[model samples]
Target: MSNARLPSFRFLIGFEAAARLGSYSRAAEELCISQSAVSHQIAQLEEQVGQPLFRRKGRGVELTVSGRLLLDSVGKSLDQIRSGLSRIETYMDDSLVTLVCPAPVVKGWLQPRVDRLLQEHPALCPIISIDETARYIDEMDVDIAITREPLKQRGVLEVPLLDDELVAVVRPDSDGQPAGMLCLETDLTSDRIGPFIREHFGNLRRLAIYDDPRLLLDAALRGHGVALLSRLLADEALRSGQLRHLAAYPSLPLGTLWISRTEGEPRLPLVRQVFDSLLAYSKG
Candidate 1:
């Protein structure tokens, strides 16, 4: 706001057009205004800036040193403003809700309950973002977010979504002849689960290691090995009998998963509706 005394946006636009086109008549034609109007705007802007912004060069105009410097700053500022305006258009769309979370939650949790969500709110259009990390809920424009750690920012409300308990599982038909072990990479490095696994199942060869729990789930389903992953991620598979708890090891407590939203009143009712529905689903 320090630029409070700066010339009006209208004058800046006119000045930018004239400077870019290098001709007052061409700028006027493009702006659908009289050539004299462009001249007047330039004169007003230069007066406010305390310098001449342009000089005559044959039939066209060329920018002065001051004009070039102003153009560089004004051009970038205009672009940033235009980009914000464009984002506003998307933000105002009632059908769209931006949801951010890790990929495992999307596969094991949200995907299973999405159909019910749509049935409850047919008009909702979810923009699911699993690939991008949303470190700041307020700054990312995320209506709802699922995170491994709770956000403690002033304007963010974080609630427990799931307990990240590590469980060893395998295909139901393995018949005690399962392949090597498949484990989430994080579990292998964690203080609690890593030592437990190494102490109990040190003889079992590792078939594969994955950074994502969903991948470990798939590998277990295909009978690749006795895959170790979050119990939450394997919830659906276990419930459906596609997989079962490995009898050799007990489930270990890891961490908690959190769901968060921007605290206070929301811009739209649809955001609150989605958040409430997701919260209920997680609890159920």
Candidate 2:
């Protein structure tokens, strides 16, 4: 066989991190390295593969087709490593709280306080996962779950998180009022758009929801139409004056956010740790 060796696992990990985050700077920050180091490692990886993996954008980079194919391999290997580490973790008894919440809840709200959690509980680590809306409470892959509606489970302790108003987000330079546009938001909706629209607004004539909020939100940002976005998602835009609420004073009545545990002393300590942290922030 030839003497040429494969790229190091470390290099693969760096590439995977860069590709997953879509920024070399973020990859460096996450991997705890300098941007130059990340770039060098990616260059080495590309040399090993005999092809360019990324193309430069204005200030960053985008993955080439070859890079996208490599991401699947790297992700699978990384996940396997994670699973092996978790399996080993079961032998040692340490406190770990897993929070299963909605996308915006994870990004907008919980993310801000994660550092504080680490400072308080040095030995405890929090695991967060994104769970869908189709009542996957008990079936969720995490120890604690945040749900919009009460989930049916035996001996599960539930605490209300908060209820925030929905707002509309559109491009700032857009010419028309948000009230006269089609709102695009919500993914994996459990209800029909026609009735849901009428339930929230008396006139269901103008609004419709698509499959993914990320897509619709992007469209809204491009001056398309009003998106019925959660306060969690639209808070930044509202604060920056990039968008406005369609209502005179916050018309939508969004329900409560609930944090639930799997019952009894087995999961109580972990549940209490998260509950105490979130209770201070919850309005409900």
Best by lDDT: 1
For model 1 the local lDDT of residue 152 reads 83
Residue 228, candidate 1: C-alpha displacement in angstroms: 1.3
Candidate 2 per-residue lDDT, tens place, 103-132, comes to 776665667667877777677777677855
Q: In candidate 2, which residue ranges exceed 4 Å CA deviation?
A: 1-95, 119-124, 132-141, 171-182, 185-209, 221-223, 239-242, 264-271
After superposing candidate 1 on the true structure, give the runs of residues whose Cα lies further than 4 Å from its correct spot: 1-8, 11-72, 131-140, 155-157, 262-265
Whole-structure CA lDDT of model 1: 0.84
In terms of TM-score, the best-performing candidate is: 1
Candidate 1 colliding pairs: none
Q: For candidate 1, what is the TM-score?
A: 0.73
* TM-score of model 2 vs. true structure: 0.52
What RMSD value applies to candidate 2? 13.1
